[model samples]
Target: MNITVVGTGYVGLVTGIAFAEVGHEVICLDVDEIKVAKLRQGNTPIYEPGLESYLIRNIEANRLAFTTVPTQAFAEADVIFIAVGTPERKDGSADLSYIEAACRTVAEEIRHSTVVVIKSTVPVGTNECLETMMNTISLHSIHVVSVPEFLREGQALSDTFQADRIVIGAQDAHSSELVRSIYEPFERPIFLTDRRSAELIKYGANAFLATKISFINEIANLCDELGANVDDVASGMGMDQRIGRSFLRAGIGYGGSCFPKDTKALVQIAGDVTHDFKLLKSVIEVNNTQRHRLVAMAKAHFGSLIGLRVAVLGLSFKPNTDDMREAASLVIIDELLESGAHVVAYDPVAQSQAKRILSPTVEYANSVTEAIDQADACLLVTEWDEIVDTPVDVYCKLMKNPVLFDGRNCYSLDEVKQSTLTYYSIGRNDIIHAYT
Candidate 1:
């Protein structure tokens, strides 16, 4: 199959590369000339694990290509995937301008019958509207199928190859079958449903996952008040077969391109239908407040952040990807700096990307030791391997005050109990240094 994937962002790039890896000829289309040039030179613009290697190998085998010209890529393609970003608007709705433009281009450029697969996360009824628009504009008949991607960052390749189930949503059986055939190479269960249900599936899954994180964080907060350990609580709860644990870890809260945007968009989707989503609204509120909890913990310890030097570890939302969108570190660092603290931050791979959004006043450190050296307190934001594997005693040796705030619960209470540093973590008892 000749596949043309529009918008070479995370979803687009991964989709195109994965298809090409499965013996399909794929052309990844992006409007950015520089990005296209970089892809052509076997360079990936993003930092997803195992993506660059597979991209390079597929390109070498002539199975994958990249282009900025939409007409050339779409002309003879059998499947066109709209994998553009659906960023959340101020009102919490998904901004579909990019999807509209991509569909318009596909409608105008395609020369024959093509199955248009929407891999981008959009609001419900988007595919039906797109099909109407494509049929109206195109000379040939177009079949628009909703095939929302479920790949996770840092593990995109594994998720693609080993997906639990594939959902193919189309109005017509022919379109559904055609899309299903494309995934025949991967022996995964395929679910066929209407476009509306499929669209809601993606949003619903993210919202529920976000809810789980918020629920655990709330539980962790209560545990903190009761002097109970969240780790043991989560472990005991996870033993139940009905409630298998995945997003049960209590942290600074969920962040990334998906949960924050999708949860808000789903809330707005409910509003459009005149349904008030109060539970989801509270979930969003809890997540927002959870990010600030670490900052408050720091302030309580120091009495005043003024003239203090704070060390921050991990700037990315999560480890293995250099994405800083909605990262807890951003809010924590901003609050720390506003209180007149000198901030030094470190991440294994995200420092460069972090510099773009973070204040120029904050200093960047190359290593954990450098970031924590002579700092008044240290905050572990992202649980990157480098930060997690560092010796607990290093905090005692490096920081001026030796106070550590573990937002991700990277260290165990037993380990912190043996250390001389004052330790604070979510949903756990604070380990105060004897001298502090």
Candidate 2:
């Protein structure tokens, strides 16, 4: 299949590269000239594990190409995927201006009949609306299908190749079959659904996952008050067949391109239909407060955060990615700084990316030890391998006051028992020292 993907963000780049890896001739189209130039040289704009390697190998094999010209990208393509970003608006609805612009480009460029696939996340009924809009604007017949992507950041390549199931939503069987043939090489389970359902599925999955995360964080909060361990509670609950653990790991909150946007968008989606989504509203509420919980804990422990040297371990929302879109560190650091704490943060890969959004008052450190050195207390934010794998003694030795506020619950209480470090974690009993 001759495929062209619009947008070169996490979704578009991964979708294009994965298709080429499966032996398809794919041309990824982005409006950015510099990004296309880099992709032509087998370079990727984003940092996803193993994605750059796949991009390079497929380009080397002549199965993949990149272009900024719409006509050149869409002229020879059998299928065109609209993978542009639908960012969240202030009203919590997805802003489809990018999706609209991409549609207009495809409408103006395509020379032949094409099966247009929407791999981008959008509101329900958006597929039908886009399909109608494109067909109205063009002379050529355009068949749009909703094939929303389910790939995760940091593991996009693996998720694409080893997807649990594929959802195909099309108004016509021919368009659906054509889209199915493209994925036939992967041998994954395919679900046939209507366009609206398919669009809802993408938001529903992310919202549910976000729900699980918020639910666990709430439990973790109760555990903190009740003197119970959330790890044990989650483990026992997860043993049930219906409640298998995935996003059950209790932490600050979920943040990335997807969850924060999708959940808020879903709430707005519900509002569009005049339905009040009360539960999801609280989920978002809990998460917003959860991000600043560590600061509150620090305030209670010490008299004040003023004049304190705080070390923030991990800056990204999650590990193995440089995405800080809705990262906890953004809020956590803000609250710390507002409380007059001197912040020093570190992440293996996200420091440079974070510098753009983080405050200048927040200092960056090269390594975990470097960030911890001379700090009054440590706060574990993202639980990256470099941050989580560090020994308990490292904190005890490096910190000025040997106090640890672990938001991710990375270290065990037994490990802290042997050290003089004061450990403060979410939903767990703290190991405190007597001195101020």
Candidate 3:
């Protein structure tokens, strides 16, 4: 199949590369000249594990290519996928201007019988709107299909290859079969539905996962009050066959390219349709609260962060990726700075990008140890392995006061108890200095 993937962000790039890997000729189109240049040179514009190698290998095999021209790329493509970013608007709805623009470009460029698949997360009726728009604008008949992507950032490549299920929404059988053939290599259960359901599935899946994290965070808050551990509670609950554990871990909420924005957008869309999505609203509130929870924990330990040197262990939302769209660490860092605490932060892959957002305010460290050096206390934001495995004894020698705030609860309470340092963690009793 000759495929053209529009908007080469995380979803677009991964979808294109994966299809190419499965013996499809794919051309990834991006408006960003620099990003296209990088991809053309076999370099990934974003940080996704295993994506760079796959991109290089496919490009070498002449099965995959990157381009800035949408028309040329979409001209003879059998399936064109619009995978652009639908960023959240101020009112929480997804900004569909990018999607609209891409559609217009495709409508003007499409000259042959093509199935246009939407891989971007959009509102319920977006597919209908696009179909109308395409019909009105195009001379030749074109089929519009909604096929939302469900790939996570760090594990996008793996998720694409081993997707649990695939959903393709089309108005007719021909369109459905064409989309199915594009994804036949996955050999997963496919859901064939109307365009609206396919669009809703993407938002619904992310919103539900966000709700799960928020629910656990709320439970973790109660656990802190009731003298219980969320880990134990989550673990015990997860043992039930119906409640299989996936997003049960209590932490500083979810952040990245998907959850935060999608949850809010869904809530907004529901509101536009005169419906109340209270559950999603609560999920958004809980996620917001989780970000500030770490700051409150930090203040509880030091009483006052003024004139303190705080070390932040990780900067990205999660590990194995450098992309930090809505990272909780940024919120923690801001709170620390506002309290007049000098912040030193370290992440293996995110420092350069973090530097752009956190410039002149937070100090970037060379390593986890370097970030911890001379700090009054440490805050473990993202559970990056390097920070999680750092020995407590190392803190004994590095900092003015040996203290650790495990935001993600990466360290065990028993392990912290064995060290000379005091430890503060989420959903657990704070470990204080016994001999201080």
Regions more than 4 Å wrong, model 1 = 430-436
Best by lDDT: 1
* Colliding residue pairs in candidate 3: none
What is the alpha-carbon lDDT for the whole of candidate 2?
Answer: 0.90
What 10-residue stretch in candidate 1 is worst by lDDT?
Answer: 427-436
Write one digit per residue (lDDT tens) for candidate 1, span 1-436.
8889998999999999999999999998999999999999989999998788899999999999999887889877888989999898999899999999999999898889889999999999999999999999999999899999998888898999999899989999998888898899888889999999999999999999899899999999988888787888888898888887788999999889999999999999999999999999999999999999888998888889998989999998999999998889989999999999999999999989988898999999889999999999999999999899999999999888899888999998789898887888888764443112
Clashing pairs in 2: none
Candidate 3 positional error at 48, Å: 0.9
Candidate lDDT scores, in order, read: 0.91, 0.90, 0.87
lDDT of 1: 0.91
Candidate 3 lDDT for residue 231 = 85
Candidate 3 Cα errors over 4 Å, as ranges: 430-436
Answer with 1 or 3, whichever has the higher TM-score: 1
Candidate 3 per-residue C-alpha lDDT over 155-245 given as tens digits, one digit per residue, 9 for 90 to 100: 8877887898999999999999989988898878889999988989999999988988999899888887777778888998888878778
Which should have the higher lDDT, number 1 or number 2? 1
TM-score of each: 0.98, 0.98, 0.97
